[model samples]
Target: MKIKTCLIQDSPVFFDKDKTLDKVEQLTKKYAQQGCELIVFPESFIPGYPRGFSFGATIGSRTDEGRKLYSEFYKNSIDIESDDIKKLEKLSRSEQVYLVIGVTEKQQVNGSLYCSMLYISPSNGLLGVHRKIKPTGTERIVWGEADGESLVTFHTEIGKLGGLICWENLMPLARMAMYKKGVEIYIAPTADSRKEWTATMQHIALEGRCFVLGCNQFFTKSMYPEKYRSLVADQPENMCPGGSVIVSPMGKIIAGPLFGEAGALVAELNLEEIGLSKLDFDVIGHYARNDIFDFNVAKQPEMVKENPTPKR
Candidate 1:
């Protein structure tokens, strides 16, 4: 089966969830009209990615202004059960497309937030969400860690869909976990726009014998609210030059590595390439030596307990 896919490389209406979602609706409609079945948005495309802002944290000190900024950010973040998410789900159903997008997810009980990938199937209202298990670098300050429960792959009509977020793609074990799940469409919504990032995407496609879709936002300092522009004043105008791309199972760049722009990269992915690519190199199959190496993911709490915990 061949699936028509689109990767959106555009910034959001920073700190404005309503306006950002409106943009999402508009873009989704535009691409769906082009017959794209799977449409992906960049990381944190709902409200926006916090590019140059630091939430005011020294080793032992915090600032009130930063706290206020964080409060504003939290307000803009989306709750999974919120009408904003429901709107996205309804859009997927109405457009008849499988939608995958990155979001800043807010916990209802606590005020904590998570960088999450939300999956919506046209046939199903909402599929599920995969919270970034480990937020990279300073991201740890804003987002909480996700448990094994979120390291999941969904079986869809196109194929088995799964992925890691941004730098999490560097985690070999994490990639293995997805490969073990037989992921055929590996979706990576990332903030990394460095040219080197494309190499990583290609490697994942080759390693897993799966198609890889990498999406990122093309953002600029001016894109932030005027009041918040000072936070990124020292940085260059172009904060992130979007490096969205699509790689085939054989490590071929099929779609793009769109940079310095706001647009969509559309491509048709042949599912049969997955099987052909694996015929020679299947990391979880013919290429793996499970008998020699004991690998485990915390898919269950007890799975972690299987190994002895070191004394603190």
Candidate 2:
């Protein structure tokens, strides 16, 4: 099967979930009109990635101003059950394209947040969501970790699509689990835009022998509100310089390394290459020696949370 996919590297309407979603709608229609089958966005592109600002927080000190900033961030985040998700569903169906986007997903409970991915199908509406199983570094302060229930792959008209947020791509067993489920379009939505990030995508495409779609946001100090600009004033140009890219089954860059730029990088992918490449080094098939490696992926992450013997 041949499919056209788009990676959105545009900046979000920083700190405003409603405005960010509005931008997403416009972009969705723009690409759908250009004939994209699936469109992916960067991590936490819904409201924004709180890149540089610590919100006046420290190890043991969260000031009143910090709490106020956190509250503002919380208010700007989109809940999974919110009208924002419904609007995304409607956009996917009306645009006739699959939608894969990253957002700061607010939980219904006390408003805990997670860096989440939404997999919406044109025909299936909102198929499922993949919440980041673990937050990286300082991210743990704001985002709550999810159980494996969020590790998911969705079947679509194009192919079997799935994703992991940012550094989770480094999870060897997690990648194997997706490869085991036959993920063809492996979407990675990340906040990291370093040149090395592109290499990671290429490696994954080669390792999983699957098409890799990597999306990142191109953010600058100016992207933030006037009041918060001073907080990011010391930052350099292209604070979150984009490196959104797409790699083929052969680990070749077909679309872009769109570093320091913000736009859609679209490419037409030949899914047959997946099967052809798998014949050479199938991760789970002819290449596997199950006797030497006994791996288990828990259906419910909670079931194995305490097991802690290095499993996804």
Candidate 3:
């Protein structure tokens, strides 16, 4: 099956949920009109990525100003059950497209934030969410870690769709879990726009023998609010510099590495390329030496108890 897909490389309405969601609605309608069956957005596309902000943190202290900024950021983030997300679910259904987007998700009870990916299906409403299992570097200051429950893949009529967020794509174990679940279309919604990032996408495409879609935000320092512009004054004008791209299963660059602008990269992915590319190198099949390498992903402690290795 061949499916038309779009990767949206655009900035969010920084720190404003309503405006960002409105943009999402408009973009979805625009692309779906162009016959895109699947549309993916960049990491932190809802209320922006917080690319160069410190949020007032030092080694031993977090200043009051930082706390206020964090508070503002927290206020703008949405919960899984929020009306904002429900609106997105409705958008997917009405547009009749598979939508995958990145957002700063909030836990209502504990006041924790998560860098999360929402997978929406036209017929299924809200399918599921994949939270970033690990937040890279200072990201831990703003985002919380995800347990195994959020590590998941969704099987759709188009293909087996799943992915990691930003730096989570670098986790070998996480990639293995997705591969074991037979992910055919790996969606990488990220903030990293370095030239090397495209190589990582291509490597994953070849390693997993799956189509890869990489998306990032085309953000500028000017996008920051006037009240907060001074905080990012030292930063360059182009903050994120989008590098959205698409790669075939055989490591071929099918679409763009869009940069210095906000736009959508569209492509038609032939799913047959996956199987054809796997003819020689099937990571989970012919190439895997299970007897030589006994690997397991212990999501729960109970599973650990089930297969205990001998202790010295």
- State the RMSD for candidate 1: 7.2
Model 1 TM = 0.95
Of 2 and 3, which scores higher on TM-score? 3
lDDT by residue for model 3 (229-295), tens: 9998899999888899999999999999998899999999999989899789999999999989876
Give the alpha-carbon lDDT of every model: 0.88, 0.87, 0.89
Alpha-carbon deviation at 33 in model 3, angstroms: 0.1
lDDT score for residue 25 of model 1: 93
lDDT string, candidate 1, 133-204, tens digits: 899888887899898888877787767888888988999988888888888999999999999999999999
lDDT of 2 by residue, 1-312 (tens): 899999999999999888888999999999999999999989999899999877787888888887888888899988878788789989998998989899998887767889999888776677788899999998887889988787888666688888699999999988887887778899999998899999999999999999999999999887788999888878885699899999998899998999877888999999999999987898888888887988778772321111111334
> Candidate 3, after superposition: displacement of residue 17 in Å?
0.1
